[model samples]
Target: MTDEHPHRPRLAPLPEDGWDPSARELLAPIPRDADGRLPHVFTTLVRHPGLFRHFLPFGTHLLRHGRLAGRTRELLILRTARNTRAAYEWGRHVPLARAAGVTDEEIRRVGAGPDAPGWTPADALLLRAADELHREARLSAATWSALAADHDEAQLIEITMLVGQYHMVAFFLNSAGTPLEPGFTTEALPAATGTADDDA
Candidate 1:
């Protein structure tokens, strides 16, 4: 969908003086597709080569070689997208989630929060952990206990890092007014208003 607010600043390409061209070249082997190339808030970050380089390896690792199952990764990502209201992230990952076998209905229910019907207990726990992490910046004892029951230490670390990564991504996208992809938009939450039902 055309961004209602497209007049925001477009980030320029990274300069060579501050960073190794070889590293960028290494990263560029994975060129963003037409969709990925669409300038968004993320591109703006490249303006600071140092910050871009720091973030690049982790993003590359996660997208290219992370060991987590796609379903689990997408669950964490979707919860971050919804919690932070990052339209760019939601627009991109919704399709990725489907490709990983998350049904359209299940993806829709992500915005439905904890009460979303049909979520498996495991799914609820994962989403809740993401929510708790986003809101309070730490997992509650109950949430940590639920996650511990289902995930080993490595997986738990991956999940926490993934949530933190997406949280940072969403922060940039929202703060910078990143554009959503063509024909994509954030799904409306069940309550329709800006606030969730429980907020009342």
Candidate 2:
């Protein structure tokens, strides 16, 4: 949650003075600021238009479809963002997570992870799934069983895919050093109550 971690932009964002026509089609789906500038993440990706074009459809599907509820999806995303220490991802999703009915306190608590107080059993399961995936790259049998009890096979698959997708996203944002959008702040959230090594 801390912005104290040094972040240096390795690739400059595509200048807004004149958008790349090659990437214009891909940029169409992304929300833009009043200045018509895309988020640094998208603009950074736009530097490779082919990859951005290919990545957007799957990303859009995950955001818009799937059996996972919006709240649940955001919970997983926020936790994954925290786990990876991806400040760009965390900053970008906080608003979307809030819009999906995640409380400010809940957003703050996500950094504390699955063990934080006040999460429902289902919410806890979602966080635990994300943590397990982040730490181990796969869910333990116990976590999988708990997830399967409530989520259908499709939803379970979406959960796994969503976590993996965000992990990839975090890697890109971190490695490329994507900056937070203008006016965005990387305020510190609560720290995790326990490490990922702790028993679930």
Q: What do the candidate models score in CA lDDT, each in turn?
A: 0.70, 0.83
Alpha-carbon runs more than 4 Å astray in model 1: 1-27, 34-42, 183-200
Q: For residues 13-122, what per-residue lDDT tens digits would candidate 1 score against the true structure?
A: 34335436644554454456465552444445665557766787898788657877889899889877877767778878888898888888888888777657799998
Q: What tens digits encode model 2's per-residue C-alpha lDDT throughout 2-93?
A: 34544568887887655767777778778787666788888888888889888988998999877889999999999888888887888888
Give each model a TM-score: 0.79, 0.90
Instruction: Judging by lDDT against the true structure, name the best candidate.
Output: 2
Query: How displaced is residue 83 in candidate 2, in Å?
Result: 0.3
Q: Give the true-structure RMSD of model 2.
A: 2.5
